[model samples]
Target chain A: MKRRDLIKGAGAGLLAAGTGIAAPAIAKGVKQWRMQMTWRANSPLLATGPQLVADYINKASNGRLELKLYAAGDLVSPFQVLDAVADGTLHMGHGYPAYWAGKLAAVQFFAPIPFGFTSQEQNAWFHYGGGQELADEVYGELGVKFLPSGNTSVQAAGWYNKELNSIESFKGLKIRSGGLGAKVLTEIGGVPVQMPLGEVPQGLQSGAIDGADFVGPFNDMAFGLHKVAKHYYWPGWMEPSAVLDCFINKEAWDSLDKDLQEIVKGANAMANQMVLSEFVTKNAQAVKIMKEEHKVDFRLLDPATLGHLGRVSQSVIDDVGQTDDLTRKVYASYRKFIDTVQPYSELSEMAFMNARAQLKS
Target chain B: MKRRDLIKGAGAGLLAAGTGIAAPAIAKGVKQWRMQMTWRANSPLLATGPQLVADYINKASNGRLELKLYAAGDLVSPFQVLDAVADGTLHMGHGYPAYWAGKLAAVQFFAPIPFGFTSQEQNAWFHYGGGQELADEVYGELGVKFLPSGNTSVQAAGWYNKELNSIESFKGLKIRSGGLGAKVLTEIGGVPVQMPLGEVPQGLQSGAIDGADFVGPFNDMAFGLHKVAKHYYWPGWMEPSAVLDCFINKEAWDSLDKDLQEIVKGANAMANQMVLSEFVTKNAQAVKIMKEEHKVDFRLLDPATLGHLGRVSQSVIDDVGQTDDLTRKVYASYRKFIDTVQPYSELSEMAFMNARAQLKS
Candidate 1:
C-alpha cells in the first residue's frame, strides 16, 4: 500500500479502538478534530448520540470535517472533559451539564435536577424557550461553546433490595448515588455511598449498598443490577431526564467555516433527538425483558414518599439556584418557564398518560 | 443590477408572497426545487417547522440546494400535495400523514389516531421501533419517499362550548373534527361536523358548531377559537399528537448526490424535533395568554369518558387497519411497539407527571 493509504488505514483502525492517536491526514482542505464522549467504553446506547453527530458531520460535509470519536478515559478522564475542551486540548467533548455543577450551579438545571424537566420539556426549553442562549452565556465564560447533544429520557428511580412502601423506608437505607440526589437522600436519613457504577452490582449483591440508581432499565440491565436487586422503583424523581452537553473549544469553533459550522449545529440537533428515541425504545425493551425473563419485582414510590421528596427537592433547588448571579438568572428563567408550561402540560401530557393508564387498568 | 440579479430579486419578492414562481437560477450546479406546505398562511407555529428544514438545508448545502417553500393553496391545493409529489409536478411537499389517509389507511397511524401514540412515543416508533421502514414501504408504493418531518406533541382535546363532565356530555354534541378521531366521536354519539378552520370562530359564535377540535392551543388560539368557545378540554384523546409528513418525488430524490441526501435526512429529523419544541413552548404561552387575557375555562374529559373513547378508538383503528394488507402489517408493528413502550411510559412519564401535579396542587 502507498504510505498515505497506510497512514489513513492505521488511523481508522486506531480510532475504532478508542485510541486518540489520529495522525489525521489533512489534505485538500479536509479538517480533522478529536471528539470524546463521557459515556463509558463500548456502551452502544449512550455512545449512539456522539457517533450519530460525528457520522452525520462527516457524511453531510462530504468528508470536509472528520471528528475522531473516543469513549470516556480513552483520551482524557470523563471528569476532565470540560477542562480539556475549555483549554483547547480537546476540540470537542460530550457529557451531561450536571457534571460541571461544581463550577457553575446553573449547569444543574441544564442537565438534571430532582423532579426536573422531562425529555420533551427540557428539549423545548433548550431549543425554543431560551435555554440554549442561557447555556451559551454560562459556558462562554469557560471558553467553551455548548450544544444540547444527547438525552436519557425519564429514568427509573432506582432498584432497591426492599420495597419502598412508605417515606420511612428510605431512612437508614444505603444507596449508591451522587450529586444533588445524594443530598436529598441525606436529608431523609438515607446514606448515599460514593461507588463506581461498575461496582454497583457487586455492592448490592454483597449488601454494601442496599439500593442503586444507574440509568433506566437499559443501562441498569446492562450492569446486571436487576439480578441482585429485588424491587425496581418508579418516577426517577432524582433525574426525570438528562440532556447531554456537547462542548467545543471556543477558539477551535471560531476557526470553522460557515458550512462546517451549520453542519455541526444541525447534526447535533439531530443527535439530540436520536438519543432520546434510542433510550425510550431500548429502556422499554429492557423493562419488558427484566419483567418477563428475570421476574424483577417492580414497584412505585407511594404518594406520601413522593410528596415528601418533592418538597425537599424544591427547597434544595431553590437554595442551590441562589448561589451566584448566573445561577440566579438561569433559575429565574427556568422557574418562569415551568410555571408557564406546567398547567398546559398537566392538562395535555400528564392527563393523556393518566387516561391511558386508567384505560389499561 | 444585472438581468440575472433582477430576476433573482423578483423571485425572492414573489416567493415571500407564497407564490410558487421560482424560475429559479440553477447556475453552477446549484439545485433549486419548489416545496409546498399544507399549513395555513401566516400561521407562524406550523410554518416554523418547514422553514427550519428549508433554512438548514440551504445553509448546510451552502446554496447547492435552494428549497423554495410555499404554503397551502400557493402552489397546489392542500389535498393535492401527495399527488403533486408523487407525479413529479411538485418537487417536494410537507403536511400531516392524516391528510392523505383517504388514499392509504395506514397513513393515519403515522399521523394521529384517537388514544394513539404521544409525540415521544410516535417518534421512538418511527426512528427505532420499525415504524419508519413500514412507512417507507407503504409510501414507496405511491412512488414517493417519506420522512417524519414535524410534530404537534400532545394537543388539547380542543376547544368546547361547555364543560364535558361525563360520557353523557359528548352525546348530541356537535364538534368540528376529522378522520379516525371523527369516527370515534360519532361512535360516542357526537355529531362530527365539517368546517374550514377559517370559519370555525364564527361558526362557534353562532352555535353552528358547538365546538371545534383544532391543533392544540397554538393553532387553536391563532384561529380565535378561545374567543368563541368558553371551555378548553384536553388529554387530546382524539388526536394525542400529530406528526407532519415531508415527501419527495421518487425520481427527484434518486437524482440527488449522497451528501445532499444525508442533508435531507438530517434536516428532516431536526425539523421533526424542532416542530415539537416550538409547539410545546408556544402552546404553553398560548395557554397562559388565554387563561389570563381571555378567561378561557379549561376542563378535562373524565376517566369514564376517556375509557369509552379509548375503547371506541381501538375498534375504529382496528377496522381501518384491516382495510388492506399493508395497513394490517403496519398496525401489527405499531401495536407491538405501543405494547413494548406503554408500561415503561406509565412508570416514568405518567408517574412523574402525576407526582409533579400532586406537588403543585
Candidate 2:
C-alpha cells in the first residue's frame, strides 16, 4: 500500500480519542517502507546508518519490510527532510530538526542549543529526563515523530579569514551559520547568513560571507572551504552538541504491528551511533591535514568571544522562553535536565581543564 | 617538528630501515590541547576510546598537553564531531576504517563483513584503496596510531520465544534491524520487520523475537534476555561491522612541534567513527525494559547456526589473493597503528565491561 495510506490508518487514533474509544486502529498488511536520508551518496554516516537499518528490518521481517534509502537530491532537497515526512509525502527521513528552526524555534534547542548538553546527557533527557515528551508535544503539532538519529560532538568554531581574539572581533563579521547559533551570533553583533551545505564554498569565495561554520574537517575539506579561508577556529558554541533526528510521518508511524515499531526505534539508535562514529574518523584526519600539512591556522574562538557568545545565547533562550507555551515547556524541561547533568560532566571534564591550565610546565 | 617525531614519541611505529633519524625533542612552552570526541562517556565507544587517551596523557605529560574534549561522552557522542587536532590519539583516536568501505571497498557494501572483508580486509584493504597512499596511510600507520577498542555491533538475533514461519512467515516476523538488507535471511528463510517507536512492547510480549535481532539490545533494554529469549544466536553475521582503533599516547603524540602535527589523523581517523559509535548509544537502550517488557526464554543455539556461520568467516580466503593481500596490508597497518592505541584502552573498557556485564544485563 502507499505510504500515505499507512499514515491515514494510524490517524484512526484521532477519531478513537474523539470517540473515547479504548484503542486505536492498527494499520495492517504493510509490505515495505522507505526512508530518505539528507546526506549525500557517500557520506559515511548517512550512507551506513540507513544501510544498517535496511539490513536489520529486512532480516527481522524475513524480507517483508524493505527500507529503501534515497540520498539527498534523489527524493528531495537535504533541507526538506522534515516537511516531506510530516506532510506524509514520505514515510520517514533523516536530518537535524534544528535545520527547521524557522518552523519551530524549539526544534533548534532539541538538536543543539549553544552550550547545550553533550550527546550522552541529551539522550538521557530525551529518553529519561522528560525531553522527549516536550519534543513530542512540539513535533506532534508538526505531524511528525522524531527519534534521535545521530550527533556531531562539539564542532569547530568555523573557518575564518582573520583571527578572532576578542568579542569586538566578532562584531559586524559576516558569517554563514544557521539554526539557533545564528540567532546568538546576531545577538552578539555578528551577521549570520544561512545557506545550504552545497552552497557554502561559493558563499565564502564570492564574499557573500566572511566565513561559514559547517561540520568539521572531512566535510569542510571535502567542500574545499580551506581554500577560501585560512584561520579555522574551534568550539562550535552554537551547536555544542548538534543532534540529528529521524523524522517519521506520525500517521505512517502508528500503523505498524507492535514488533515492527521496536525495530524502527532500534534501527534509528544504531544508525545514530554509526553515523556519528564515521564523522569523527573522517573529520579528525581532515583537520590534521588541514593544519600541519595544508598550513591552515587553527585556533580557539577566543575566550572573550566565547563568553560573549554564551551571554548572547542565554538571552536568546530567555526570549524563546517568553514567546510560546510549547517553547516554555520544552525550555523548562531542557533547562532542568541540562542543569542536573552539567554538574557531573563539568566536574569530570570542565573542572579538569581548569586545573590543567594551572599546571606548571 | 615533523610528523615522524610524533609517531616515534607515541611509540606506535618502527621506522623503515634508514628512516630512524631522531628529531629534536619538545622545544617547550606548549599549551593545553583540545581533543574532540566521537563518543559519549557511557557508550562503549566512549568508555573505551577517548577517556583512556585523556587519562593517559593527563598523567604522562605531567600536564603539558592538557587535553579537553569539546563534545561527546558528555557533549557529543556519535553526533557531535569534527576533530581539529594535530597528531593522532585525540589528535586522533577511534573511527571505522570500514566506513569508506564504499570508496574503500568496491562491492555494493556498507556493513563491515557478513562474509566480506575481515577486520583485516576492512583495515588491510584500506592500504590498497589508494587510501593508504593518501595522507591516511602515513597517518594510519607511523604518523598517528590506533587500536581495536570494542565490538558490540557483532550482535545477536533478538529475543523471542516462538517458532519462526516459513520464508513467507519471515515476511511477517516484525523485527528491529538496520544496515544491509536481510537479503541472506530472505535467501534462507524469514520476513522483514520495520515499525515506529511506540509498539515494541506489545510486539515482544506477543512473541516478536520469535526472531528479531538488534545488536546487543539487551544492554539497553529494561527487560532481561531471559524474559523473551527461547534462543540466543551468535557471530552476528549481519553486522560484521566490528570496530577498531587509531590512537596515540599523549606525551609521545604531543611531542611534535605545534605546526607540523595534527592528532586528528591516523588513529583518530578510524577510532572516532568505529570506537564509540557502535556501542555508545546501543548499550543503554538494550535493557530499557527487560523485566517490564516481556517473559524471555533463552534458546541455546539455532539449528541453522553452523550452516550460516560457515568456513568463510574463519578461513574462506586461503590466500585472499590480491583481495587478501590488500586486506592483509590494511589489517597490518591497523595492527601496527593499534599497537600504540590499545594499551590505555585496555585498562579502561576491558576492566569495566568484564566486570559490569557480569553484574547486571
Candidate 3:
C-alpha cells in the first residue's frame, strides 16, 4: 500500500479509538514517543529547549504525535541518550554532538569549535553550507538521524576569580572547559579540565579550578558562577556558539509518513529559532542582574592574549583536521565557509556592533 | 454543534467530492489561499521568502491549505499588499512594516530602525521582549495579523562614488536612502532621498544621487550597484537588519483551525530562519565574486565619521520617539530593550567578532 493509504488506515484506527471520548480529536492514531535530553533538571535554556520542541510538535500535530521528555538522569544518564536513541530504547534524544566527541572526533565540528562560527554563521553553514550533509554522513553511519534543534548565542569566556591581564595568566590555569575548547586551552598552556555542569561551582569554590567556562550569562547566572568568581570574561573563543541537536533512531524516523516528517522538521526549526531568541533576551537580562546585584566585573580578553590564543587555535584546528578522512573533509568545508563568510560579517555584523558601542544611547 | 463537528462536516463534503480519485487525501475541503508579495518578480531573497513559506505550508499541511503567490505588480502594486490583505482581497501579504511608514510612523519600528537591533537581537526582542505584542497592537488595529517571515543580515552602508573619510564629506551628499536611516542621514549633513529599488542604480549612474543604500552584496550585486559606484562602505547602520513580514487578514487568520494556524506560524518561522541563512551564505559568496570579478573597493566609515553619525542617530531617535503616544510607547520599549541588551552584546558578539578579526585563521 502507498504511504497515504497507510496514514489513512492509521487515521481510521484512531477515529474508532477516539469515539465517545470528550478529548479533542487528533490527526490519527496518536503516536506516543519519549525523548531523553542531556541537560540537567532546571538547566535554564538547555532544559527548556527540548520541552519547547516537544510542545511545538504536540500542539502543531494536534496531539497526533505526543512527545514526553525526560531530563538528564531521569530515565537514563545524560551520556546514554544517544545510545538509547540509537538502540531504539528512546525515539529521540536532545543533546550536543560534542557530547559524543570521544566516540567520533568529527562530531565536535558539528557542535562548535574554538574560534569557530558564531550562532548565525553556524546556522548558515549547517543549513545552507555543507555542514548538515557532513553531519548526516557521520550520524547516518551510527544509525541515527540528527537535526540542529537549538543554539545558545556566543558563550562567555568564563568566570574568573582573578584578573587575567596578560597571556602569562593562562599558564597553569586550571579552567573547567570542554570539547575543542579543552584541546585549544591545553595547547595554550592552560590546564583544561572537563567537569560536570553541577560540579563547576563547587570546583571553583574549593579552588579545584581557577575558572569555569559554561554557557553565556543566562546559564552562567543560573549556576551562580558570579557568586564564586568575581570577574566574568568576554569573547568565548572556545565554542563561540553551542548547537543542540535532536537525534532519532534511523528506523523510527524512516517509518514516519511524509507529513509527519515535515511536521518534525518544522517543529525543530521553530524550536531552534525560539531557543536562540530566548537566550539572547535572557542573557541580556541576566547580565543586568549580575551587574547590579552581584557586582560582577565584565572583562575582555586582552588583544595580545586573544591574538596568541587565535594562533594556538589555528594550530589545534590543523591538528584535528589531520585526524582522519571524515575529519579532514568536515574541517576543510568548515574552514572554507568560515573564511568566505568572515569578511562580509566583519564588515556587517562586526562593524555595525562596533559603531553601536560608540553611540551615546 | 461543536468545532470538531464542524470540521467533520467539512470532511464529509470533501469525501463526497473526492470519490474514486487516486490523488492523496488532504485534511478536508482544501482551503486555497492567495498571497500577494511586495517584492518584485526578480527580487533575490525577498521574493524567495514567500515562496518558501507557501511551499512549507502546502507540504506540511498535506495540501489541506495551498497558498498561491503573486509577485509585486502581478496582482497589485508592491505597497498595496497590506491593504489588500486587510480588505480580504488577498488572504495574506508579504512585505515589511517599514513600507507603511508614511501611513503610520510607529510601523517603522517593527521593521528596521537606524542603528537598531541586529537580526538576532531583533528576533529576540520581537519574539521574547514584547515586540510581537506591540506589533499585534499596531497591526491588529488595521485588521491584519503580522508575522516576521524573512531577514536580510546587516545591509551595506551604501555604494559611494567617493570615499567617506570624514563627516564633512556627507555635506550636500544626496543619497537614495529610506526609512529611519534617511531621517538620521538628514540630521547629519546628507540629503536622503526616498526612491524605488529599481531606480537606485540608475540614479547613482546618472548623478541623480551621490550614493545609494540598497541591501547587502547579494541584492546590491543584482542591481549592478558596483558598476555605478566603486566605494562599497561598511555597516548599513540605517537598517542593521531588515525584517520582512507576512500580514494575514485577521478574519481569515482567525477562521483557520488551531492546527492550520500552527502550521502557518511554523512555516513562517522556518522561512525566517532559512532566509537569513541564505543571505549569509549568498552574501558571502557574492562578496567573494565581487572582489575577484568586480574589484569593488570596500571601505569602512572612519571612526570620527562613525562617531558623529552615532551622535546624530541618537538625536533622530529622540525626535522620532516624540511623534505621538503610540510611537512614543514603541520607541520607549525599543530603547529600553536595546539598552538592556547592548552591554551583553558588546561583550559577547562584538568582542568575539573583533577578536576573530585579529586571528591568523
**Best candidate per DockQ, number?**
1
Model 2: per-residue Cα lDDT over A1-361, one tens digit each: 4854554454444334442212222334545555777777667544666666666555544444566666775655777767777765567787777767778766766867776665655765776667767777788888888777676755677988766878777788899887677888887789998787889888888888887888866778888888988787776666666677777778878876554665566566555555555555455556656756789777665445566667677788778766677777788888776655553333222322222222212
Per-candidate Cα RMSD to the true structure, in Å, reads 4.4, 25.5, 8.1
Decide which is better by TM-score, 1 or 3.
1
lDDT of 2 by residue, B82-108 (tens): 222222223444444333333333221
Model 1 chain B lowest lDDT segment of ten: B14-23
| TM-scores of the models, in the order given | 0.93, 0.50, 0.91
Q: What is the lDDT of candidate 1?
A: 0.84
lDDT of each: 0.84, 0.52, 0.84
DockQ of 2: 0.02
Q: What's the candidate order when arranged by decreasing DockQ?
A: 1, 3, 2
lDDT of 3 by residue, B189-272 (tens): 799888888889889999899988888899899889999997999888888988889988898898888888988998998899
| Model 1 bad stretches (over 4 Å) | A1-25, B1-25
Mind sharing the TM-score for model 2?
A: 0.50
How well is each residue in B13-74 modelled by candidate 1, as lDDT tens digits? Answer: 64466433233466878888877888865577788877888888888898899987877776
Q: Candidate 2 at residue A86, lDDT?
A: 77
For residues A1-361, write the lDDT of model 1, one tens digit per residue.
3844654564356446553323346688887887888887568678888888889988999998888786787656798888878875568988878788788777777868887788888888887889889999899877899998888988878989988988799999998887778888988889999897789999999999999988889889988998899899998999887888898888888888887888999889889888898999999999999989999888889999999999998898899889899889999998988888888788898999888888777
